[model samples]
Target chain A: MRPSATAYIYIAPAFALLLFVLFSPVIYGFWFTLFRIEYGAPTDFIGLGNYVRLIEDPTLLPTLSRSGVFTAACVVFTIIIAMALAVWINRLPARTAFIVQMVVIVPWIISAVVATLLFRWVFVNDIGVASYIIQLMGFDAVQPLNNPTGAMVLLVAVSVWKRIGYAVLVLLAGLKSIPDDYDEAARIDGANNWQIFRMITLPLLKTPLLLIAIVLTLSTFNTVETPLVMTGGGPGDATRILAMDVYERAFTNYDLGSATALAIIMFAGNILLVMSYVRLARWQA
Target chain B: MSTITLSSAARARATGRHFVPRLSWLWSGLFGCLVILNIAPLIWGILTSFKGQADLFRFPPAFVSFTPTLENYERVFLSGFGGNLGISLVNALAAVVLALVLGLPAAYAFDRFNFPLRRLLFLAVVASIPLSIGAAALLIPNYVYFASLGLTNTPIVLPMLYAAHQLPMAIWVIKGTIEGIPRELDEAATADGCTTFQILRYVILPLVRPALGAAAILVFVGSWNEFVASSVMVDSPSLRTVQPAIYSFIGFFGREWGPLTASATLAILPILIIFALFGRLMVSGLTKGSVKG
Candidate 1:
């Protein structure tokens, strides 16, 4: 058989499974949001009613803005810290760099639910390490988990904590792709450290930085696990991000129409990120 | 291959290395804080896991001073986390095996062939990589579709979905690695009258083994750690996976740290070990796949 014909045969099984699991659902979901689906069946044709309700709903806008806050916070911290760690690793002797990476990695490598549990233990009320240490330092023991703003900040911190390792890895990969020649050439021309970085390194690092930002934004914006596990969207909806809102609308409220509508919106945002990711990715590839 | 770091640290000088500026103590202190920030939760959890119930409420949380015991582990095991752990293992193992079986030939084809619609098909695969990981968007669509098909609440469904989810990544990793192998080897084998299957089995498979290993580890981690769909789709107690089970345990052991910490510790131990052993490979693989963490 010709190679082209055989290629079809080679890809058939995977394509079959992926179509059902990945592709079909997209079609199904888009169709699903157009109706009032009840007990696994569409009972009413409600074209755009679900989406209109979603837009007009009081709770959803706040939920979405909360997600905006969450995603922005996580993206900023993750990129900055990861960039620092990556640059630091680049300068270090090989062994020390590896050790630093290894230390930062453990929290991120574990399950989100597990990581949430672990981080919560650190700041949990009376027995929490943070509280005890604060008491020892002659300060008031602040209960971050119990207050609204505190919970949101704590949630963001936990997210950045777990997310930094992966960002550091990707940014480290980005940093390594830059050569020493740029810095040396700039130095030879009397450029100092800041000038070499601001001009030479930062611009070269732009694509990778953009790629990581998109990836991090996608993960953090639609993340349901950490908030669900830690705060459960509590402290009076303080941490009720868009993803959790979708979950609650569907499972908790049994309102499939609203839930799927929000999901489609989120999915649309995700596709934009994926498109940018694909563009930047192939340039590197 | 799989175990290689994304890039060697010993490689050419990095212009960004002087990022921290002159004060060694400043960066040193920052690095110290980073280590503590990252490592303390894990250490505290492990310590909490070993502490007696009384120690949990103590005014000062004891680090190493608390008398350690395995009662929490015993409690968690006896309360049927063993079963949840087993289901997770089975699902993760199945997902890895199935991803390889379905991904390899296609990855091989993707790299070696000039075929119609190849780019489109490959694009479809790559798009699904991140789509599968970001659970909030995928959960409702997946659940609704599976419910329509009567596929929800089944043991096989999770693994099937997990495999499909991991397939694109597997193909990306394996295909990228295969592309790195010298194409001349395949031509050389073909010149010797070897069939395509023989060349694949004898030449390509062995050469791409590390990628296969890396793909397997990624798939296992993805499958094992999946919670959003697992929690929503499968409601039967016997079929519950570890992450969801741990999530539920919050309700079961509210405000009780011992058993909760113990379960969290137990659940993550295997992944931690795999990561420690294959840290380099996974770093390389995940960034190579460039889709997931």
Candidate 2:
């Protein structure tokens, strides 16, 4: 049925507010990117100059590589660990399983900044318990956020730890969606547990796994807070990812034109990735 | 042939019995390791937060402080730090409310109606992701725009920007939840002579409450931890959120570790409490909204 005029009335306030607050700003971003506008000046049409400048920039390649590496490593770690956790929890009796699951999920809900702060404390040179433990285990020192490689490793580690809970939950949901008859049938056929899981459980879990992978990849690519708070992209830009680079160029250097260019590229890339995932979903359908 | 089959089947059963318990033990061991790794940082932070600065620097570290004082807590809570916490909570809560108000009905419209330019409009809304790349990317134009409107440095600007940034995701999520409610309910309401607003208010609103709560919590947590935009948009010391406050505590040389940790703990408490009470719903809410949307 067609919506009544009153339906239009109900939707009006929301549309008006979104137009002002959300839509206008986004439209203005594209407009600003095309113009050679400083923070406080009349806009001049620059055409594709900003985009050209972005292509010619030296730092973009390394930043992209760093972001890619971060995403790949973090997604791999998150998925594997979350799957293991979900399998373990699935084996438990109901109530205990739920309590343990709740405990695990706590980290996911914690604020990013807070997690960074907590991890920063844990990685501090002398007084940190983690550092102390590592030292006791015969390491000289663990500079988790101080060295570039160390920082990247820690960033991925933190990302995985914070996110594993959600991954576990998602995987559990996927596991529950699978029919027990498949497992029973495999058992009756004298198939081993590994063979049953490999053939049935893994295939059934592909969709959820793909969803988790896509979300994690996007999030890792877009992440700013962990590196921002934990390392400040420190030990001399070793930990600097694309998003931080974009922020530094725009805010620190006040290069609106180039910053917008980078923003557009990043935006395009994310959209493409998401669209690819949608295509995969459609293919499965 | 029968003897061979029976012997192989018995060997297979024996092997399966041995493998199952061993695999179970291995999985449990891995999960236990993860639990330790996950809790390690927070536990360390809590311990360090209680230590004196001198103790913080002591070699081998002091896991158990000989002397623990309320000094750091006092500095954080009584020494003007609480004001920053208060501002963060107020800004985050206000922004969440604004986003929900602006997002819910739009979500309903998208879920229920096929208006002109529907896909295009929805795509426009979903494209807000990149706008959040950094405060800097949008800050220049926003600064100029807000200045022209006489809203720069005002409390309104941060929430407005946050609400705008968060609206798309919120709308998409609520729309997904709204779609999950079958259309027949609305038809029934209409057949009973209820107006659209009456139907939404009486029927849709109550049904979507769980999704609404989930969106509210997510938005609130996002705004509370928001740093880049708030830092750039609001320059006044009193207007800064908790994240920037933590940043400021660490100057060029070194950080005030004790009070910083205390403040960090304080900042995390509200979200933790919310999660503690609504943990399961929150997870399902995130996955449900995110997976579908």
Top-lDDT candidate index: 1
* Cα lDDT of model 1 by residue, B212-293, tens digit: 9999999999889888888988999999999999998899999899999999999999998998899889888978877322
Candidate 1 has a DockQ of: 0.58
Chain A TM-scores in order = 0.94, 0.90
Q: Which candidate leads in TM-score?
A: 1
Instruction: Compute DockQ for each candidate against the true complex.
Output: 0.58, 0.41
CA RMSD, predictions in order: 7.2, 3.8
Q: For each candidate, what is the lDDT?
A: 0.85, 0.73
C-alpha root-mean-square deviation, candidate 2: 3.8
